[model samples]
Target: MTSETQERRPLFKPVRGVTLAGLIGALAFACGVALTATSGWLIVRASERPVVLTLLTAIVAVRAFGIGRPVFRYVERLVSHNAALADLTDRRTAAYRQLVPLTPARLGTKRRADLLSGVVRDLDDEVDIQVRVVVPLITTVGAALVAVVTTFVVHPPAGFVVLGSVVAAALVGWIDLALERRGQAASLAARGQVDRVAHLVASGANELGAIRATDEPMTWLAYAQKNVEKAAFAQSRGRAVGVALALAVTGVATLAMAWVLDGEVEAGTINGPFAALLLLTPLALGDVVGLIPDALGSLARSSAARDRLEALLTQEPAVRDSGSEAAPNETVPHLRVRDLTASWTGEKTDLGPVTLDVAPGEHIAVTGPNGCGKSTLLAVLARHLDPTGGTYAWGERDVRDLPLDAVRDGIAFVDDDPHLFAGSLRANLLLARPDADDTDVLRALERAGLGPWLAELGEGLDTHLGEYLVSAGRSGAESVATATERSISGGERARLGIARALLSERPVILLDEPVAHLDGPTADAVVRDLLTASAGRTVVMVSHHPIAFDALDRVIDLPAVTS
Candidate 1:
């Protein structure tokens, strides 16, 4: 997902195999209709005492149609499915490209499950439309055209009946689209209601319990469920109405074809055997038209999904991508900031308008009250964001002149919550530097004050650490309960973050309240260890504990913004 190479593609663009799939699907349906008509004609002709030899061609035609129908249908499915899946891969990659600029700063909580889920589900639904609606609709239209044309050549009046049936079916499809569009609003409202209640209950459970309103959420939940039911029922009704109206149109067309064939046969204008063929062709065409209503319903759903996706992906990145590929020359560059200001929302001042500077290997601490932009400053320093105002120079060149990726290569950030992926201890460190080996990992662990902790586990680099690990007291805590999947107390966890940062060996390290959740003693210990381990490395740490300020080279206290 963090990959910078972007081959962004249009979300709703047609995939390559769609046309070929449509043609194959059309031929498959056409074969079925032809088989039905030819069989009907053959049965009628046989009833007139025709010789077996006379029926040979009709028999062979029926056999060919039967086999061809499934064959073409199979081929169509193969092509359409492969194309759709391939497109999904490309679209997912593009979606990630769009999301790269929004990470950390723009998408709060670091990993936004809701936003990610919405993107995945909506993109999938959009891609599904190509298979479920577009290809099938094309097949239906093509098959109907073939049926109508052949029937018309046999008898113009019969041809008109088939065409009329198709038009009526199309009208039913229009009705389906209207109903679907109307229901979408209700469905969205219901979903929103459900989400609101669910979030309120999940995040405010303790508050609700204190207020003795635990049952209130149940009431809201029921109400939300009711709305969901209503929306679902409305959608079902649209499908029912479409199918019923389609069948009614089919019946009318069948009767009209029968009447026209009767007139032609009576006037000696059509043979009795051939009249059966024309009559049944229109009736067989009902299958083709019958599905249009549902296809349109699918189209409506895809359109809604596409609109949402467009709204999300179309947002301008909060940061300007310099797109510079130039590599940084200095191992530890001098940092200089002049009247620098940045905003997360791009609408309000989130950080700075203050001047700051630090020579290589000089450590600094930024202390400020909440909303004074401590974390925002870290984000800007990490090049995750663009400053709305001011200039920050690294190595005497404006940081903006450096490629984001190139500049980021020299920076490491360890925040309050450092995510530990579900993997081995070695794998977690490798995320910072994939090329780092066992010796490098061990060296980094030693530097971050995790060497004693690692030795205690006995698993060495193979020791597994998953989503969350409660860190025991300090390094080499006696008999800290160890598990194959998760082990390590809060202090150990904090040091692991430091180890990763050290592993990357970035020139500058930014700590965003790294011990915000740890107890005072543990937090102070972790902070002291980080500063000691960070010798000769430029470090900017955001902290509230004054104990931490004593060891820093300088402290910048940010004032609260006035309303």
Candidate 2:
């Protein structure tokens, strides 16, 4: 097991479908196979007319036994597949929601793509073990036990042989497990490399053009290719070990069957049906034993993935929720911070021992030099990051005492680099309020100066965008068009983000350089419109331009905040 796997939270309950299917499958298999074995005994004792009737009865029972085999297989597949997908969905949603409270600024030194990959892909892969490995393992072992016990009751020597072969096969399987575990660790490392390489390739695509002018693209490709090789090498080694173990077990079973037949013949106790039973017994045991190593390999990976995902799900956010609610009046203070201090890591303080207050209808501009913790201050006030020390209150209640939903509903924030999901202009705008009507969406879009841009596009509000465009690539020209259609100019993207914030219409709005890419005149117009739009709300903004601060009710200079 991986070190991270130990961190996984235990599943609250076994998956219902997998558990139920496993139970039914194990019982059905035991009964069906045991009855078939009994038929073998009857065929050996009976002859002529009795033998023919007995054979026919056994064939009918066997046919019934196999009747729902496909159905059973389908049930197993459906149960296992859904469990992984459901768990992945839960983890992805939780991770993104956790990110809402932490904020991008609070991520400190972590890479965005690496974290994204872990939360999205990594967690999903991990939870699959619950259905795939755990349930199947339980059923297989249970079925094996039933088979062994039945054999023992019929013939003690056959039972002894089966038990001994099982023990020997298990020992070989354990050895395979040891080899597979090492391979699994290597596999995980290889996957991490792949993730990192993909991230670099994405972020450095433009830079890669310049680098390729100096023939450096090959170097980057080589590094990525090497990671792929490492992954393949590890996987091959694991599968090879499993295959070797299976072959060895099958060889041992074959030898045991040969010995059994020789001994029965010498004792003159061999009957046609009895001989057939001996031959079938060893082969059936071998088939079951062979499945062990393959299942073990999958289990190891799934176990590792499950543990990592669980750890993330169980983690408490660094920020605490506040039970405060927004009251409409401008007289009551909407937010107040007293000597609040915070740090991404506890060892080094990033902001304050500073005090601030903003009442409803107040507009505050926070100005500072780069890296002076201006954004961090706004994040804390917005309750995206909790104060490590001191108290922050909204209205009369402490911020931490406020309900998380209440705090979020009362506040809307627009970052300089706003994330736009893959969708049409109307679809993206409506994300702020899914049920918003066309009028509501167009109003927000026009306010952010996006209506003209949307209208200019032939597809208008229905234009498809984002990573999904890759699917529409039918030719080189189509691929180029797809990329261009989805691509947003920096200024346009900024306005799109602001449009979303405007649609929210929260009591408190926190904007981090909303006019980041606009020229002098356009920047002034945006600030003026923003101030006008936020007439009866609390606004906190980080800005450097003096003109941007004109309508602010308060200006908090970061130089005044001390560690």
Candidate 3:
């Protein structure tokens, strides 16, 4: 578990603001029930030819209740939404912080895009409960109780009927919740599988076609889609049954109330106008319950989302964030290791059971055949994963005793696939160093062999990239077209990644097959520029390509087994 979640807040923690919103919601629902009852009485009494002045009060009451319903409802919505959004902001921040430490290694096989999407979507569902579930459920129950007591006062038997109907509806709601809970879990699981398969097939279409391997992923995608459809249909069927039962209970209760009222009138114990008012009250309350199938489903969905979040947030991170203090501040600190061993999973070692040392400003390459742990060694050096056995140090300071981010901040680790966003050149480069100016950006680009590319651009730093939304002004937005569609190639993208690393201005650079995707000539050029741009910095390049070893750097090759 992360430090952010150590003092975790409950999904619906007790708060005065939420309580106030609930009370407002209840009041609004009561106003709706009262309006229907009064209007019924007014109409019935008018038909009976009462004294005109006596009718004046009933006419005025109907007007007040009618206006109050909408007005109170608006206030209720305002209060509930305000409180919910405030809590949502806080919860989103906390949940994201908890997720950061467990990323990559602990996140399984999912891409960062998939992980981020799930987190954002789940958090939204969890927060929506305050407005969608709690407000409506509380409002319906509170207003129904008020109707029950008022009916019992006017006609005792009718009151008992109202209470029984309400109890039955509440039971239906409970059953619906239980069924929906199961249905929602299944639907989410199925939908997640479908998305995963669809993404895999869509993203790897070219590779699959090239290798004639499309059949299996395509078949799996179809199966996952069918499962989603089945899950969705089952969930909808359960909801339909629940709604039908709740409405049936209301219909039965309305008839029982009528039967009792008819007998009361035959005995001359109650009047027609009074009976109309009492009958209308239950129908109005029943309408509230009738409107709640959507709310019930939302409650179930939110519960499922909360469970997913809890599962993720409570997971222990793969690496320990140790020490009360960060690493002592240093640029180009000497790196040393003694019999290091590490693993992606806890059960087996994937890298090391080896040793290495590097002086400040030394350039070194870790090269090996496939399965020799070249990438795994870089993971340990970048502080992404910790050594499971033996020791590593930075300038005599044991790295295990240093905070992860503090040690990581001193190194610029660039991987094979460097993500570029859809924005202007300036906006994209600004990500590496937010405070960097246009000159710093240009210099970085020039250093990474992008000077000629920049000069070729008509707009230079203002050149827009792939599709994205750009703010037009304070009031609106516009879409930017794809700039990379015109002249950008794979080599340019690789060089851009190198430029970003140079812009980071860290004392050490770690490259993990940065040119793995480029062609022979392009890869050689990129490696040359990289070695030139990182002349002074301590550089470690992990590659099996001989072109990567062109410069003055000792190559350390790892055998299949290190002892």
Scored by lDDT, the top model is: 1
What ranking of all candidate models by lDDT puts the best one first? 1, 3, 2
Over the stretch 4-67, how does candidate 3's per-residue lDDT look in tens digits?
4477557555334666676677777788888888888889999989889988988887788788
Each model's Cα RMSD: 5.2, 5.7, 3.2
Listed per model in order, the count of residue pairs whose N, CA or C atoms clash below 3 Å is 6, 10, 0
- Model 1 C-alpha RMSD vs. true structure (Å) is 5.2
Over the stretch 333-401, how does candidate 2's per-residue lDDT look in tens digits?
A: 478888788776667777877688887778888887776778778778776777888888878777777
Task: Tell me the TM-score of each prediction against the true structure.
Answer: 0.85, 0.80, 0.92
Cα-based lDDT for every prediction? 0.82, 0.68, 0.81
lDDT over C-alpha atoms for residue 548 of model 3? 58
The residue ranges of model 2 lying beyond 4 angstroms of the native Cα positions read 1-13, 27-54, 75-117, 120-123, 197-221, 322-338, 355-364, 390-398, 457-462, 465-486, 515-532, 543-557, 560-563
Instruction: Give candidate 3's error at residue 140 in angstroms.
Output: 2.0
